[model samples]
Target chain A: MSLDAATKPHEQLAEYLATDMEAVNRMIRARMASEHAPRIPEVTAHLVEAGGKRLRPMLTLAAARLCGYDGPYHVHLASTVEFIHTATLLHDDVVDESDQRRGRPTANLLWDNTSSVLVGDYLFARSFQLMVETGSLRVLDILANAAATIAEGEVLQLTAARNLETTEEIYLKVVRGKTAALFSAATEVGGVIAGADEAVVKALFDYGDALGISFQIVDDLLDYAGTEATGKDIGDDFREGKLTLPVIRAVAAADPSEREFWTRTFGKGRIAEGDLETALALFAKYDTLEATRRDAVLWADRAKAALDAVPEHDLRQMLADLADYVVARLR
Target chain B: MSLDAATKPHEQLAEYLATDMEAVNRMIRARMASEHAPRIPEVTAHLVEAGGKRLRPMLTLAAARLCGYDGPYHVHLASTVEFIHTATLLHDDVVDESDQRRGRPTANLLWDNTSSVLVGDYLFARSFQLMVETGSLRVLDILANAAATIAEGEVLQLTAARNLETTEEIYLKVVRGKTAALFSAATEVGGVIAGADEAVVKALFDYGDALGISFQIVDDLLDYAGTEATGKDIGDDFREGKLTLPVIRAVAAADPSEREFWTRTFGKGRIAEGDLETALALFAKYDTLEATRRDAVLWADRAKAALDAVPEHDLRQMLADLADYVVARLR
Candidate 1:
């Protein structure tokens, strides 16, 4: 079953991106190592080494390279992205009280929430240090703003956990804050630190932002229909009572009986067994997943189109493919 | 009471310090204002306006000025220190499950643990932003390292809670990480940003470290013995099952009856109503409070001596008095 060497996913990437992604992994491993605290390394390794596709840092590294960055600090930027992402995951698990992530016991489950929290704080400190090493005040500003936005998004999500009144505008804001903010910032800073022109930086930012919106939309849909390769179980968003895009659409299409079911499943205390199936059927009946997929493709196309306004290069081609890859699972 | 016509305490030396502390306040108020997210200003202002003694930031302010550095960036350093201190306090209240802090409702109590944790993170980000504006890599390094140490110390305290086997070394390590690290770093960076010699930086660090240690010792002692001005609700530490230095020493000095009391009060959750009185009497019987006070004075003296190695100035004399003030209530 071994793939032909030419057909391998890593081999299939355009030459420079393959190299950049590899470089990002190397930097993450090297920087996350610490001599001061064993618990830090121990807790962080669970998320960092969990093989979660390295999508966010790749956005950063690729943007930096594409923008003609020759400096060595892009590696640091990539590592900072991963660190921030990991810190959020650590805190997210605690907030969600979820015992499993990536089919592995969460850090909160393995080591108490206290350790997860402290380790998350430690990673944040380390991220700040890595960014400081870059010696770009602009990078610090972008990253700091993104950090605040990410937390706000998280708190917004926390508050919006059970409410069914989540409009598309609020959802987009949450997505922008929680997911798109960092994704866009990662690329924005990439173009920023490379001394790119303002136009190029803005394009990279818009491109990243669109890609992130599409990526998150697809994720919300797939939580009701994704397979094991995606590392998410079907109906995760539903079971967690998250009123994501699919549920939003489905709830709009819900009839009176369906509304009762929704209330019982998400709002009321009685979560009977087979609720996921009923929810999925409702989603299919409303064609919400399909609608969601179309939205993802629309945004993905917008993401690629945003890049068309930027100066073209091999990295631009890779970025186009990367945007496609973000929604690849949706189709 | 018209004593202002004459010399106030530390007036000869601390008059400038008094002026500088005012400057730190102005900076804190200014930096904490944000126009983007109103919640940020609200959450940050809660702790910033809580009327703390402002000891940590004052250390930064005093250290920089004492070293003959008149740079305005010390205001940034002071604000950074205060932000870090505020962030830690927010997280500590959550970790300690505290309802009241300084006779006021804790952030966790007023809001929730989620808000407290998230807002603490926001403040941390804001603090980094402030430090980055300083444009001193050395300052960043010092503050980042101190932040890590502070988080580690808090983690140590979390894991050490309810454990009776906490040794003196562990206690000191915890205290240094939680309190002394920031104090030392605040002073160390003050000397650093001032372009002081390494010798002065190290001396200031020692001064701050000893002062912080003395401050904590006095705090623990005050929990066992002090009047309202010093904010002692006697034996509160015992009621919390926190094994302070005096309590640890008293446990070591306990007989069979006292051993039973220790096991029941601390090891088990059977602390009776009068257990605090009994614990205070045990501290008195073993003279552990007096011994702890003596230890505090020793550190205070060491803190005063740390300045002697540096060149003498009015601000230097004020730092000596500040150290005295930290331990004065005990006398």
Candidate 2:
């Protein structure tokens, strides 16, 4: 299958699920509004309508459809997933103090950190409400556990930031927390909501988890080797001194002077001119970026393999393609 | 009915519920622990063990006991309330840029904002997990709505801050959001988990709602008329330009010059020396402080009256006394 611009897996999924996607969008807008707090709607609209890929919610919808669900509550679940994602982004921007998100000024930068924090909180509560409306205790359990894991992963990443002792184990845990937890929950909840078989649910969860890991690894990789096509500024993780997977691996294999270079840039947060180039040189000497790409590819493959348990449908094929597309940038 | 130091309502209730409170404390300690992130417990302990009166959780326990709840999950519910409270405080410090909470340096001040935000999120998720453990959908629904109301209230207060046009209705809404929603939820969920009858649960809800309103009104009033006994600095709200009840009423009754003062101090956030005194004098001129005090007393009375539906018990009497104690500072 020749993957063209119009044939991107996510885009294809969005088109196939357009009616359901529209319902999900409507539900999101309706729930995000506050009868009392207009700021809730304003801040939520800023992010929700920002045209991000809506990929997480799509995962939820696709998994439900693929599981042969024809229920109404999948819309609620999809909106719940999106709200959680948006809440995390709002808080993440405040934590990162980043001025830009999705090519626009962030809520924290535009409104205030107070709005970002509180509005993020409002959306979290909203998401909780939406999930409860599904009336699935099992679904609630799945999302609640995911919420805890996401929070733990974030705190782990924060504590691990710029620390040379950060291991790949810690990095993977953070990746699971920051990205894959939600992904797995999104897919797992769909299967659970549909009353899918246990094995099928497990397969959905595995697929989401692997795909999320692949997605995050690719993101981290792009911060180093990205072109303009990725819409990422190269070496952002380096500039922030983030101890991502590549850096953690390279540091593990570093000699004395290279260790000193890592210590200066990441540990103490000092970056001189041409530091990006020097870091790239170090990554090259270590081939850690290539190793990171391989890791992403491996997870993508694992994601595709996990789908073997699912009943094969066009949606299932799209999901497999989606997994492949996540790591296809490396090729 | 002379309230002695050792016989304070909360103190007496604490003694009565000591065993359950201990269990709740244990649950809190156990749940707040993160296997991956140590920062969760550290930040939680700083606030949780800081010796702030556990008034909110006590409401949950007292309500449960008063309604004859003998189950183990009331302890879980009480701890859930506290976790939600602690989570809000963590986020509140970051939102308010607060340094001191319960007379100790805040978590945001001690660690960084990232830890506070992420830890707050962790506690929120932990609270969700605890509530889910009870396996009561009604309890979950009640807490979920409370969470939404609380968030909406905070956002409304944020946008309404410094706006002189903020009405008493808006102040009441903000008060409910910041303090009362959780209080009522704490009490209401207890009755719910106990499987109390609808009337008793409604009574518990009303009692908590009125008590929380009275408690917050008194706290706001203390910001103007407080002494050493209240542990509140007089005019802190004025210095912060907050639009609490007394100030809102005073603004409503202000003449052109008084309006100018308010516009300068609050609307423009340009507070200067003697502003607090002038604001107090204006409150006196309009009798708004005394009026606000009356509002607090009325709500306290309402809280006591609402307990009429609750089965007569010693805990009920203590709860009534707790309401009185909240507004006792005015006298």
Candidate 3:
């Protein structure tokens, strides 16, 4: 799609950050290359070139520009953010045993799980290498902790996926780890690298954090809302036994018969044909999907509110709109 | 197996670094814990408590002390090195699909490949966190490059493992990646963190590089030298189709009939009951086993020679002796 056709806030942001984004893309290509292992680049290329929005890297660029960063390190941080995001996607596909991502075959399917795992590792290492080039230990510290949190969230999801006892609190923690940690880190490091004051850095973090949460909640809602072109099919999360917010809320409000259905399908892993339709019906009965959507909107509003702490700028407005655009996709 | 009877040079080094090693061990324990994912500690403890030599961390500690560094960051660096090593072992077990390590069932075998992969990733992230705490950009750079090299070596090995056309040069590259990269980084960062001079840092890097190469060659040699307690059984590498030094040498010297045999067994993956015996016979006929042993000794001597540039110290002597001790076990 052309920039003129770009309706999403992130698409417009990508257009605005196009030049710096190109630099980040170039650095990604250069860093992902390996002299000894040709497979590393091959696998990385499959995912990197899959045409998903460069939203995370764009956040880094946006925050840096908002803080008036003039040096080359912001590009480095942007690339670092993308590498970390791509690496996690590779590993997540393996963990989820997924075949399709971004409407294309996953690396594990195109190559093998082994390639996906090792290449993900290479990118993660490369990400660290890029972050160290910024010469800001605070940035490194922020990004490093985010990396650890991302992995920890994935591990937590592994144990929490099939359990009916999973609470919304735990689900929020997982969502934060899987989505928001990188989001917040991507933006926080940008401000920190630009030598922005603590207030602005903290504002960037809060904004990204709220935006990420809203984005993921919408994703969970859309899995039930049936958006297959995004490669996330209806019942994909349900079949995977993931206790996302909608299901967690529905289960909490479940009657005895409804509770038995959830227990049989999700808790006991005895999913039958047409169970997805039944789960959808149950979600409708309790209005949990609408409830989840309301939560997402609230988070997006919080994200926009956090932008108030920063000085007024065009990038800030775009970021505020970006948060709104996340939940806007739902309607 | 009593501590008093631990006659390996590494064991002696461990004794010398006991107090520091205790601190390193404590740091490892503290850092590996995950409040959200109990599975992380369970899987990590399986490998961590299995009584490894803690050799890589010891190298870091030794290098730091030998450079007159009495700072506390060395402990963090040492712990970082060990975490990276432990993390690699976890992922290696998954990549190799191994069932046993160090005479115990592997984490992959004990828990699952999923746990191994995720927990390995967690430890990797944790290691980066620890390294960044050192606040030395150069140290971060060295460890980051080493981590990338380790992953690249692994990916290269994945692509290069079974091909009959794999050469000695490729084998050396893979060996450097899988074994020596971390070793060299573990020591180099120690000196770098201690603010050692250019010559001393280069010497430490050289010592670690040569020592790691020697260490791996001997491990490969011992696999066929028939030591079972080491958990690397005879023909394990052959069955896995790994082209180590002995097999590379044997293949290089094979006659037409032996060529067909090597091609069928390793190249084509048609190993049979008598294949190990035949492979051993071929090694004996060409004396490639002894030839590999000689190569190991040469590298060990090179490792000892690298220490000449550094000032003489008790730890230096222990490191030199450790090189000799790697191959000594084979005899």
TM-scores for the candidates: 0.82, 0.97, 0.96
Model 3 clash number: 0
lDDT of each: 0.78, 0.90, 0.88
**Which lDDT tens digits does candidate 1 get at residues A154-240?**
667766666777777778888987799998998999999899999889999999899989988988877877888877877767766
List, for all models, the DockQ compared with the true complex: 0.36, 0.67, 0.61
Residue A89 lDDT in candidate 1: 85
Model 3 DockQ vs. reference: 0.61
Candidate 2 TM-score over all chains jointly: 0.97
User: Quick one: ranking by lDDT, best first?
Assistant: 2, 3, 1
The list of candidate 3 runs beyond 4 A from truth reads A1-6, A98-104, A228-231, B1-6, B98-104
Query: Candidate 2, residue B181: CA error in Å?
Result: 0.4
Docking class of 1: acceptable
Per-residue lDDT over B106-182 for candidate 2, one digit per residue giving the tens place of the 0 to 100 score: 78878978889999999999999998999987888999899989988988988887798899899999999999999
lDDT by residue (tens digit), candidate 2, A42-91: 88899999999999999999999999999998899999999999999999
Judged by whole-model lDDT over C-alpha atoms, candidate 1 comes out at: 0.78
Off by over 4 Å in 2: A98-104, B98-104
Between candidates 1 and 3, the DockQ winner: 3
| Model 1 pairs in collision | none
Listed for every candidate in order, the interface RMSD values in angstroms are 3.6, 2.3, 2.6
True contacts kept of 3: 0.71
